[model samples]
Target: MIRPKLELADIFRAHGPAWRQANAGHVSLGQLKVMSAIEACRTETLGGHVAGCASCGHHHIAYNSCKNRHCPKCQGPAARDWMAARAEDLLPVEYFHVVVTLPAEIAQVAFWNKKAVYDLLFRASAETVMTIAADPRRMGAQVGMTSVLHTWGSALTHHPHIHMIVPGGGLSPDGTRWVPCRPGFFLHVRVLSRLFRRLFIEGLLALHRAGALSFFGDLAGLAEAGAFAAWLAPLRKSEWVVYAKPPFGGPEAVLAYLSRYTHRVAISNSRLVSADDATVAFRWKDYRIKRGDRQRIMRLATGEFIRRFLLHVLPDGFHRIRHYGLLASAGRKANIGKIRALLGQSPAIAPPEAGAEPVPLTLREPCPCCGGPMRVIEIFRRGQKPQSRAPPRDQAA
Candidate 1:
């Protein structure tokens, strides 16, 4: 067996409280809850159970996981559950990965108004894709997309962007047949960049008019209409960043990519190099650098590291994953069925029964000594030790 490396929980357990006390005024309730949850995740504070091997009689204690979306240790099971539900939605076609990123100016405002700005980001990107695809000169189909919101960059900075997994084709406007895109191409990035910019800026202006946006710190003056319009002036001429990667090899590749991005938090435990009382070190990628020099180490004071991690807590109940166009949940089942029928393919997978419990992927690892299944023979309450079971008379001798 291999031991796990350093984790985010370790850093939180060591420095969370001190950082919270120093920045109590700046931190939100949601951020504080996330910090507390990460600090106590999988520890005795949460609870645990005891599992024993029936063949070898070997037993070990296992702690409960926090199950918080922000917890690094909890995302594996969450991603698996999400994937199970999404398996039925796969189409028999190539998929494209498109990214829409906000300029630094907008990102600065989005830092304080996360919910509003992030919602605008999703709306603008989805509209751009669907609108362009529907044009008769373009793909001339109604595409479906799964868009995920990511608020942090590789260095854990507040760089807001959208990651969209889009099928390479769509249903005809009349729903009579499947419409496929060009073999390996999806959309023109330049066109998407222009439309996304117009839509996003227009939405931002509307939000400002409705008094739904707030400006503060260095951007406080933007509350005035003149200042806000002036702030957006340069953005109109500057090209927005919209990138589209080549089509995925197949459906399996799309699932593999979604598993990584769907539930990712600011940073994963594997990137953490070390943490101490005064400072922490971690690996980060600098995309601007050459490929071989991209990987680099970043060290920051413990408090600052914690602060940067908390920068992405998100407003409570704000969804980071969303679907649009044909993939929208309202009628996704019917839409998928129609598409499959048109393509002369059978259903990819059956949907789960109405009230069935999700089947566990694996109950437990095999016993190390006997290679037999392990069973949870007893459950121990928090702070309680497992009671020892007496041995058989022959074995006692």
Candidate 2:
């Protein structure tokens, strides 16, 4: 496969030092660590291995990956492992894709109080969905959903939203049978939007009153109770975004969607066009424009680009992906079994091959010359050179 002309590492390598020096006080320790990790990823600084094909004697060197969750190069294998684990949880039912977005007012507050606001976003959205679905007038069933948080827009701007993959139906309240939603719809978006807005604001206020939320910069004045209430007043009446996309064709489509979103970074290497001493250029979509016009190029000075990228480095230990209701960790196994039984589907089984140890998932490249599997015969530590090995007799002089 051909390598792209530019990558996130390229931008970081070119301007990371200067950016760190210039904004030493402004950048967080996590952001700085991310920069260093990206810069060193898959490079000589981290050490690697040399793989050679026994059949064709074709040799190649493979560098080590940083395995940082935020690295684009490292997401592939991580996503695969995650999807594999989630495969058993899939129900043979139509799946709906829903997105819940925080309004600009809350987004600004979230920018300063990321951990708190993001937690609220997840809790409020999950509560909104399960609440609406449980209502007798609505679906009247217990639904399971996997929600993933995305905090950046196409241009790497701070835009926090939750993407949820929901089965089109759920278990009946009595847990005796499957309850299917309307053939073409999941729930009323208007109702969800209103309830989501109310829940989120209420949660935010509760956090503030408990002194869990912090305000800084321009928002410092909002620390006052009256001022915070006033700031939230307009938001209560403002429309929030909560929309469900058309149902995915089947389980396959849901898995495909999850593969892309479950481990995505702010920007992918493919979207990167070029990186130079002063500026970095990348592709971005302006959704407000027509479809054709939406795909456009955006260029930012290297430092600014780094800054924008760092804006998405989540608070340490924060979970960006979450499960709710029936999928909640505590009782997911039992809930899934009940759901499968109610749907009249047998439990999924993993096939085993006699005398075969399971092949661990990886993203390493195959042998180029013979198109065979490649394995590391030896490992080298950082700053150490790989030991030279003699070529096969066929190539010996």
Best by lDDT: 1
lDDT of 2 by residue, 289-321 (tens): 855668889999988899999999998899999
Instruction: Single out the weakest 10-residue window by summed lDDT for candidate 2.
Output: 388-397
Task: List model 1 lDDT by residue over 1-397, tens digit each.
Answer: 3324678998898788788788879888898899888888777687666666778787666667888888888897899879878887999899999999999989999998999999999999999999999999999999999999999998889999999999999999998989999999999999999999999999999999999999888899999999999989999999999999999999889898999999999998889999999989999998998657789899999998998999999898999999999999998989999999999989776666776743332244676668777677666677766674532211222
TM-score of 1: 0.93
Quote the RMSD, in angstroms, for model 2: 3.5
> Which portions of model 1 miss their true places by more than 4 Å?
1-3, 351-371, 382-385, 388-397
Query: What's the TM for model 2?
Result: 0.94
Candidate 1: pairs in clash? none
TM-score of every model versus the real structure: 0.93, 0.94
lDDT of each: 0.87, 0.87
